[model samples]
Target: AQSVSQHNHHVILSEAASLELGCNYSYGGTVNLFWYVQYPGQHLQLLLKYFSGDPLVKGIKGFEAEFIKSKFSFNLRKPSVQWSDTAEYFCARPRGGNTGKLIFGQGTTLQVKP
Candidate 1:
């Protein structure tokens, strides 16, 4: 079955520190990858996505991820994080055919201190 996994359930960091969250997927065929972030009380927004072409993709708010096919990993990273960056992050993959649904991984909550 196709599924996404986020390694970190929670993360804490001081303001201006670096950030990296691990993500992995188990799918053999073609797939679409996405990282969605939900701030304190806001709706989820797309952080990044990987469909085809470049393995390394950049998204909103200075975030980026590198897709590794062999490792089946797409890890999110930021050079420096802010207190405002604190939020819940989720990794997702679109279900193949028919449904047009998205399967989300267990979320990772990041707490950034000021």
Candidate 2:
């Protein structure tokens, strides 16, 4: 039995601010980590993911995440934020094997003010 947890409930920021969303998971074997974003009126889209490469993986919209096996954590980070970046983010990990089935965390809403 494995699950994902997102510690942040809601986050607010101004334009061009730094952003980081905490994400943790409970699993004992190799797992695929993912960060997904849902815009105001759009479908869920992937931000970044890490499987078996370098610990750090980059995604679209200037987003990146680091996979730390020792920590069982994969935190999302962005150097700067923009108004367009305002969205709900979810940290997810696959259930069982790498079959593309994801167990998502409690979503975190990010609001970027001007």
Candidate 3:
């Protein structure tokens, strides 16, 4: 079965610290990768996505991710995080084939201190 896996359930960091979240997907065929973030009391928003072409993509809020096809991984990264960056991050992959459905991994809660 195709699914997304996120090992890190929670992370804590101080302001001006770097952040990296691990994400892996299990799917043989082509798939679209996405990172969604939900700030406190806010709706989920897309951080970044990788469909084709470039393996590395930049997203909103200075977030970036690299897609490794061989490893089936798309890890999210941020050079420096702020307290406002505290949120729950979700890694998702579409089921593909007309369904237009996305399977998300266990969300990771990030707490940034001032």
Candidate 4:
């Protein structure tokens, strides 16, 4: 079965702290990786994505993700995080043959303090 896994369920950091969230997928074939973020009281928003071009793709709010096909991993990273960055982040992939459907991993809650 294809699924996404996030190693950390919760993370705490102060302002200007570095952030890295591990995400791994269990698919042997091609894949499209995505990172979604849901701020407090906000709907999910696309953080970053990787399809086919460069392995490292950048997205909104200084966030970026790198896809390592050899390891079947797409990890999210940020050099420095702000208190406003606090949110629940999700790693997702489209279901096989159903691009409209997504399989998301158990979200990682990021609590950034001022």
Ranking by lDDT: 3, 1, 4, 2
Q: Whole-model lDDT for model 4 versus the true structure?
A: 0.92
lDDT string for model 1 (55-78, tens) is: 999999999999999999999999
Q: Score each candidate by Cα lDDT.
A: 0.93, 0.92, 0.94, 0.92
Model 3 stretches astray by more than 4 angstroms? none
Compare candidates 2 and 4 on TM-score and give the better one. 4
The lDDT, on a scale of 0 to 1, for candidate 2 is 0.92
Which prediction has the highest lDDT against the true structure?
Answer: 3
Give the range where candidate 1 is weakest over 10 consecutive residues by summed lDDT: 94-103
TM-score per candidate, chains pooled = 0.95, 0.95, 0.96, 0.96
Separate clash counts for every candidate: 0, 0, 0, 0
Candidate 3 local Cα displacement, residue 9, angstroms: 0.4
Q: After superposition, which runs of candidate 1 have C-alpha atoms over 4 Å from their true positions? A: none
Decide which is better by TM-score, 2 or 3.
3
The Cα RMSD of model 1 versus the native structure comes to 1.0
Q: Measured by TM-score, how close is model 3 to the native structure?
A: 0.96
- Against the correct fold, how does model 2 do in TM-score? 0.95
Question: Of 1 and 3, which scores higher on TM-score?
Answer: 3
In the range 9-106, model 3's lDDT, one tens digit per residue, is 99999999999999999966668999999999999999999999899999999999999989989999999999999999999998767676999999
Q: Once superposed on the true structure, which residue ranges of model 2 sit more than 4 Å away at CA?
A: none
